[model samples]
Target: MAIQPDSAPSELAVAEALKALGPPGLLTGCRRIRGGDEQFLLPAERDSMATRDRKARAASGAGRRIVHELLRRLRCEDVAVLRGPLGSPMWPPGIVGSIAHDEELAVAAVAMRSPSVRSVGVDVEPMLPLPPDLRAVVITSHDRLGNLDQGIGGRLLFAAKEAVYKASFPLDGRMLEFDDISVDLKSGEAATSSGRRLLVRCTARPRILALAYTP
Candidate 1:
C-alpha cells in the first residue's frame, strides 16, 4: 500500500507529471509524506538509516515505500533499496532506478535492465525560485536553459543537475561537483565530466520534478 498525501494538489497529480516524462519500459511512483512514515522502514532499512534524525527517516521511508511498490510492479517485490556505494540507492539485480524527495514529496523511478538504459535518477523540489546566492553554485556557463521562464529555470536547473548527479554516479562511481556537468533544457539532455550522457525531463505541475536517465 502507498502512503497518501495529507492535502492537495493530489498525489495523483505528482505521479502523472512524472509518468508523462518517462519513456516506455520505465515505471514511476510517488506519494505525499505523512507523519509516522518512518515506521514503514524495514529492519535493514532502519539499520542503514540509523544516523539520520526523525525527519530524514520519514522522507526516506516514504521514498522507499514507493520504491518497493514500483519494484513489485516490475515483478521484483520484497526488495530492499539500501544506501550503497557513494551513498546511492542499490537496487535489486537487473534494475536501474532512483528515488528522491523534497520537504513534502517523494518519488521513485525504476526500469528493468536494458542495453540501451544504464541508470536512472529523479529529484523533486518545491515550485519556487532558486535562491540567487545558490544559483551561482549550480548554474554554469556550459549549461543552457533554453526558453524556460527565468524564474523557474534556475530552480529547474538545480533539480536537473541533482538528478544528473545521481544518474551519473552509479556508472562512473564518482561524486560530481555541480559544475562537473552541463544541462540543456531545450534538448532535455546532460553531459557529465566522465562523458556520461543522460536524457533529462522536467515538470512544474503539482511540484517541480526532474528525471535523468541514460539513453
Candidate 2:
C-alpha cells in the first residue's frame, strides 16, 4: 500500500507512478512540497537539523520520517537516520534506502530488511528540460545514446544520473559528475564508462521517477 500524505490530490498520481516503478519490497511516501512541518525526528536527527536551510530541513525531515515509518512497520524502532559526509541518508545497520524530492514532490524508497539486496535508490524530478547551460554541463558524449528518444533526452539523462548517483554512493562513496555515468535508454540501464551498471526504471509521464537498485 502507498503511504499518502494529507490533502494532496497529486499524491494519488504520484502513488500510481510509484507503484509502476517500485518493486515489491520498496516502501514509499508522498507529500506536497512544503517546509518545516514534519515532526517525527528523534533527538539526534533533531540536533543535525541545525545546519540545513528551511527547504533542506523540511525535505530531509520528511524523508527520514518516511524511512522511519517503514522501519517501524518491519518492527525496527528508535533508529535515527543521519546525513553522511557525502549528503546521502545514513541508514541503520543492515538497512539500505534512498530519498528524493523536488520543489513539488517528496518520495523515498527503503529496501525491506534483507541481506542480499545491496542498495536502493529513488529520485523524483519534474518532467522539464535542464536549462541550456546546465544541459551542456550535464550531458556528455557517453550519455548521448544514439537514437534515444530526443524529445525526452535531456530530462531523462538528468534523472537517470541522479538515480544512479544515489544508488551507487553507498558503496562507491565517490562524488560523481554527470559524465561519470552513461545511460542506455534503449536498455534502460546506466553504466559507468568503466562498466558498473545500475538497472534504472523511469516513469516519464506526469513526472519523472527513477528507481535504481544493485545486487
Candidate 3:
C-alpha cells in the first residue's frame, strides 16, 4: 500500500493508475501487501520461495497473486510461477510477464505469446524521490528527464532501467548494469548495451510506475 498505516485509499488509487499505464495487450494487476500474502501461494510456488525471509516471501506472494490473476486472463490458469535462476519468475508457456514490488505494493503484467510482443516488464515504486546519494550510480549520461516530472525523475529512471533489464534478459541471457542501459524519458524509450530496445512508459501519480516492452 504506499507504506503507511492507513494507505488503502491511496493503495487502490495507485493500482488504478498502474492499470491505466499498462502497455497495449498487456494485462496488469496490483496488490497491497498485507503481510499475509504468502498464504495465497500454492505448494510449488511456496517451495520456490521457502528460503526467503518472512517479509520477502510475503512480498513475493503479493506479486505472484497479481501474476497468477493476469495469467488466468490469458487462459494460463493455475501456473506455479516458480522462482527460477537469477530470481526471475518462470512464467507459463505461451506467456511472458514480469512482477515487481515496493515495500507495501506489488505489481505485475502479463501478455500472451505473440511475435509482436515478445516480453514485458513492470515495476512500481512509492511516489517518492530517489535518494540523492544513489543518483550517481543510477543515472547514466545518456538518460534524459527533460519535461518529465522533476520531483521523482531519478526514481522513475531507476524503475525504467529495472523494467528494461527484466524485459531484455529473456531475449538474450545477457546481464546488464545500471550504466549498461540508457533511458530517454523524453522519448519514452530505453536501450540496453546488449542491443535490446524497448518502449518505456511511466507515470508518477499515487506511485511511480514503469513498464518496458519490446514490440
Candidate closest to the true structure, highest TM-score: 1
Per-candidate TM-score against the hidden true structure: 0.93, 0.88, 0.92
TM-score of 2: 0.88
Scored by lDDT, model 2 comes in at: 0.74
**Cα lDDT of all candidates, in order?**
0.85, 0.74, 0.82
Pick out the ten consecutive residues of candidate 2 with the lowest summed lDDT: 144-153
lDDT per residue for candidate 3 within 91-189, as digits (tens), equals: 877789899998988888888868767998888887787887767888868899877554489999999999999999888888899999999988898
Predicted candidate 2 versus true structure: per-residue lDDT over 1-215, tens digit per residue: 56766676787788678767766766777766566645656778867655647777777777776777777866678788877665778887777788898887878787664544577778888887666777787788776545655446677778878988888887777678888988776577787654667787787776888877775
Best by lDDT: 1
* Prediction RMSDs, each to the true structure: 2.2, 2.3, 3.5
Q: Model 1, stretches more than 4 Å misplaced? A: 1-9
Between candidates 1 and 2, name the one with more favorable lDDT. Answer: 1
Query: Once all C-alphas are superposed, what RMSD does model 1 give against the true structure?
Result: 2.2
Worst 10 residues of 1 by lDDT: 1-10
**lDDT for residue 48 in candidate 2, whole number 0-100:** 62
Q: Report the error of model 1 at residue 118, Å.
A: 1.5
Q: Which sections of candidate 2 miss by over 4 Å?
A: 50-52, 113-116, 144-151
